[model samples]
Target: MSLIITDECINCDVCEPECPNGAIYQGDEIYEIDPNKCTECVGHFDEPQCQQVCPVDCIPLDPNNVETKEQLMEKFVKLTAKS
Candidate 1:
């Protein structure tokens, strides 16, 4: 599943740099995760890097964009090829 940054985000700007996919961005109010670009760090790390660095623990799996590990890996491959 992709991750979502909730309103609990403190806007500390830590998670943005930690995201390997560059999915995290500063929204109008809080950091937002673009599901299209989020691969849960599948090709980069074992765990979501943003979640690990978010001080407020606002990052959580996005149920709306749920996907299996294989799907995430596929996404990672596709994204990497574009880079």
Candidate 2:
């Protein structure tokens, strides 16, 4: 599943740099996660680095866009141009 940053986010900017997919973004005074680019770090890392670094724990699973490992790998390849 992709991850979503809720309104509880303080915009601390801690999770942005930790994301390998670059899915996290500043939302005015909040932070948002792009589901299209969010792979839950399935292809690039063993765990979701953003969630690990998020101080507020705002990052949560995006139930609306659940994806399989193969799908996530395909997305990772497209987003990263994995050779």
Candidate 3:
């Protein structure tokens, strides 16, 4: 599943840099995760890097954008191809 940054985010500016997929961005009130670009770091790391660095633990799995591991890998490949 992709991740989502909740209102609990402290805007510490830490998670943005940690996201390998560049899915995290500054929203009007908090950091937002773009589900389209999020791969949960499947191609880059065993775990989601954003979740690792967020101090407030505001980033969580997006139930609304859930995907399997294979699907996430496909997304990672597509994103890498664009880069």
Regions more than 4 Å wrong, model 2: none
lDDT string, candidate 2, 1-83, tens digits: 78888888887889998888889888776888899999889877898998899888888888888888888888888998846
Supply the global lDDT for candidate 2: 0.87
lDDT of 1 by residue, 1-83 (tens): 89899888889999999998889888999889999999999989989999898878999899899999999999999999955
Give a tens-digit lDDT track for model 3, residues 1-83.
Answer: 89899889999999999888889899998989999999999999999999898888888899899899999999999999955
Worst 10 residues of 2 by lDDT: 24-33
Regions of model 1 farther than 4 Å from truth: none
Instruction: Give all TM-scores, in the order shown.
Output: 0.95, 0.88, 0.95
* lDDT, model 1: 0.91
* TM-score, model 1 to reference: 0.95
User: 52, model 2: CA deviation in Å?
Assistant: 0.4
Which pairs, if any, clash in model 1?
none
What TM-score does candidate 2 get on C-alpha atoms? 0.88
In model 2, state the lDDT of residue 70: 89
Error of 1 at 12 (Å): 0.5
Error of 1 at 78 (Å): 0.4
